[model samples]
Structures are given as C-alpha cells and as structure tokens.
Target: MKVLSKSISLFVVCLIVITIWWIGTDGFTGFTQETARVNKLIEEKPMIMPITLEDSKGRMYTFHELKGRRLFLTFIYTSCGTVCPQLEKNMQQVYESLPREILDEKIMFLTISFDPDRDTVEVLDTYRQYFGSDGETWRMARIANKLELKELLDAFGVIVLPDRYGGFTHNSAFYYVDENGRLTNVLDYKDIEGAQAFLHNELLGSEMK
Candidate 1:
C-alpha cells in the first residue's frame, strides 16, 4: 500500500508540473495568434512607398532592413521652431515608454528632414541629439533636394506645402511598418497614446524573442 501511494503521488506531481509548463508556453502562444489575426486586418490598409536613404552618420539603411521588426517613421525639419518641436517631444514620449526588449527586437525609427538642402549631415546629427537620441538604433536623414523631397512625400501620400516664413506646412503623420517590411498604419503625431497601444497590441505583442 505504501509503495502504491508513493507512485501515485509522484505521478500527480509530474502531471502538475507539465500542466504549468504547458500553460506558460501556450498562454503567450495564444496571445501571438490573436496579434497575428489583428495584423492581417492591419494589412488591408493602404501601403506606402519605401525609400532607401543615407543616415546622418552616412550609413546605408533600406526599408529592407526594417523587415523582421516594427518601424515608426516621420518627416521633420530641425530648423522649424513650430509643430516640429511638438512632434519631436511627443515622439520622445513614445520612445521612452516602449519596452527595452522591443527596442532591441528589430524595431526602427526613421526621421526624414524636408529641408534637406540646409539639413546637412552635421545639422541632422545635432538635431537628433536634441531629441535625446543615442544613435544606436535611429536614423535622421536629409532630403538633399527640394523637388526630390516633394516627389517622395507625394509618393508616400504626405504633402509638404512651403510656408512664407521658410518653414513648411506639411502633413504630420507617424507611419507604422510591420515585421515583413510592409507599410501598415498612418496616424497623427499627436495621437501618440493611441499609436503606442495599437503597435503594442498589434505588433510588438506578437514578436518572437
């Protein structure tokens, strides 16, 4: 009787351990599946053109590098003391709140300057530092030509109308890209809160470590 009881107790303990392990793995697996479902819905949204550009540091990074991770990209001119400043601050908030693991997990941030003629590599570098960028994972690029910038913006469906005071009245949007390097959603820069939640639930939440 004693031998039988010991064997039964051991079997029960093993069963319990297996149950916990299964739950630990399966729970996150289920969440990933749900995230995938939402991502499929996100794919139905219109796509944007991908640009290959040189960063302030002279490194070449393409939209292709953005694959296997999530991307948040924006257009800005550093010299503007207007809405651009507000947008930068809001972007800082979004970046600060993101999980560190997510930042390391193939995530990218791209800031393209509209006034590329004045936004040389030196200017871009200084501007990026103002936003507290560490330079390990972000790209700040200069447009190099007014016409080229306008054409690219138009291709992406973002418009930048010149302001009389040398600044521009441009469309303010924060673009999201998925792990497949495909363009996803375009949200207002001021909608940082909503943007964070959307990306977390729809993208990062499904990321494999």
Candidate 2:
C-alpha cells in the first residue's frame, strides 16, 4: 500500500509540473517572453496611441501621417553590439525578400531607437548607412520627446531598463501594425522565415512571381 501511494503522489507531482510548463511556454511553442504573440490572440480590440518620431535624417513623422499604410516596426540602439545588429540584419533580410510593388506603395519599415539621448540624428544616420539601409524602404528614427517614447514602448509591450554595464537591456521583437495603426501581430526577430511568410501573405495575399 505504501509503495502504491508513493507512486501515485509522484505521478501527480510530475503531471502538475508538466501542466505549468506547458502554459508558461505556450504549449512548448516558445517561452513567456512571447507575451506579444499570446496577447494578440487574447486582445479583443487592438489599438495604438498617438506618437511622434524624428527619423535619422531629422524628419518628423506621426501616427496620423503614417495612417493607411501597413508598418513593420522594430526598436533598437545604434551602440548595441549584440542583439541590435542581429535585429537589423533580420530587418534587411525581410526588406530584400519583399517585392517592389509592396515596397513602393503597400508598406513601410520603421526602425525607431529607444536610446534618444545618445542616438542623435547624425549618429542614427551613420548607423543606418552602415547597415546599408535605403532611406525610403527603411527609415530609422527616435521619438521626439520622452513622454511619447514611454507611451509607445509601453503600448507595444517593450521593456527597456538600464544595465550594470551602463547600457540597456530590453525586449526585442518585430512589431507588426495594420493600416489603421492597430497592432495585429508581434513576432520573434530570429524567426526570419516566419517573418517573410507573414509579410508576404499579409500584404500580397499571394506570393510574388
């Protein structure tokens, strides 16, 4: 009887652990950092707040101005030696994989910097150039003011915190917004193939020839 009870208790504990892990990792699809993906499904109404940004060239753009156009947006800091470079590379890959028709009129790629104080217009422009960014296809920018920057980051679920190394530690992902300025999806930047498929199908419906 004692042996049977111990076995039953062990089985129950194992089952509980498995259940917790499954929920935390989205059924083993990914980890809890995938809140953006999980949130999309649960979000009854998706919306974006009014925000303004200054591009690498010192040009201003706002939510109102960018309406009626789908946007592929990401956040980064030019000084980042690790994750940011990979994110930009992922952006470049996605941009190149796009069709001219979509690039010309359907969508825009916006890379906004969360590190405004350190990333000036000149600095951002230089960074963009280093990445071989075509100004029209990809416009890197910084929020004009602190208030709007916080709002934008919070709304998109991006968390930026200073690290011990006098740098930042923040969550990174590809934030996808629809024409009406509502966030429709958020994908991991490392998932290059998924990003391409999502962008193509969402914009062109059928793949370009």
Candidate 3:
C-alpha cells in the first residue's frame, strides 16, 4: 500500500509540473512562448492604448484622436545620437517609399519620445528636422506624464533602460496600428524591406477601400 501511495504522489507531482509547463508554453507551442503568445494575442485581440500625446509642434491630442488612420508608430529619445538617429533614418526610407500625397491623412508615421522631461517640444522639433521630416506626416511627440509613459511602454512591450552615458538603451521596433487604432503588429526596426513591402501591400493594394 505504501508503494502504491508513493507512486501516486510522484505521478501527481509530475502531472502538476507538466500542467505548469503547458500553461507557461501556451499549450506547448515553443520554448519562447512569450513571443508566441504575444503574437497570438495581437492577432486575436489587438490592443488599443488610450494615452494623451503632445507633438513637437506643441499640439496635444489623445490616441483616440488618431482613429480612422493607419499608424506606423515607434519610440525614441533624441539625445541617443546613435540608435535613435538610425531608427529615424531607416523609418524615413520606409516613409519615402510611399506616396507623399497619400500620407498624413490616411496613413501617418509617429515617433514618440519616452524621455519627455529632457526631450521637450523644441528638442523633438529640432531632432526631427535632422532626418528631413516635415513634421506633418512624420510626427515626433512625447508623453509628458511619467505615469502614462510607463503604462504606454508596458502596453506596447517597449523596454527602455538607462545607459551609463546618460542616454537610453531601448528596444527598436515599428508598431503598426490599423485605421481602427488597434495595435495589430510589431515589426523589427532593421527590417527595412519588410516595412516597405507591408506599406506597399497595405497602401498600394488596398488603400483606396
């Protein structure tokens, strides 16, 4: 009877472990289940983050104000002088790939500064001009409220860490939001070709409807 009891306890422990693993891996999808689950969640129920934003032009607006326009959004801190500049340049190429006339109204490129205290309205405006952005179609904005900034970053999975050089080390990615304002996809920062292709298919092929 002791032998049977011991066997049952071991089985129960193993079953518990398996259950934990299964849940962690989202039904055993993969070892990197966090990414898999996030992708799945975005596809199934894309999120809409409601946060107030102030543009470099000193214009304040809520995220809901951008509804009915497709957005290619990303985060940046102007002082970086390296990663942030490259990200802007790369996005510029993708921005130029599309027709200028079709931009700003239907589709927009928004770069939000996580460090609003340092990257003031004037700072962001100056930084954007370095990359030839007209400030209308390709906008630079910031979240002045620190509390709201944290919430927005967490919602979008953007990780920003302070560096020894008084700058930030943050993940770079283009977050694509559809016309309905739902964050549908997150593309890698270096994927220039993929970004262009998505724009072409999304705008050139189906923009009219």
TM-score of candidate 1 to 2 decimals: 0.71
lDDT of 3: 0.85
Off by over 4 Å in 1: 1-50, 145-148
Extract clashing residue pairs from model 2: none
Question: Residue-wise lDDT of candidate 1 within 1-209, one digit each (tens)?
Answer: 99999999999999889888677556434344433333443556544445556678977655565667677878888878888888888887777777776777657777888887778888888888988776556668866655656766765566677779888886676777766766677666888898778767775656544
lDDT of candidate 3 over 114-137, digit per residue (tens) = 998899999999989988788889
* TM-scores of the models, in the order given: 0.71, 0.82, 0.81
Each candidate: how many clashes?
0, 0, 0
Error of 2 at 6 (Å): 12
* TM-score winner, 2 or 3: 2
**Candidate number with greatest TM-score:** 2
The best candidate in terms of lDDT: 3
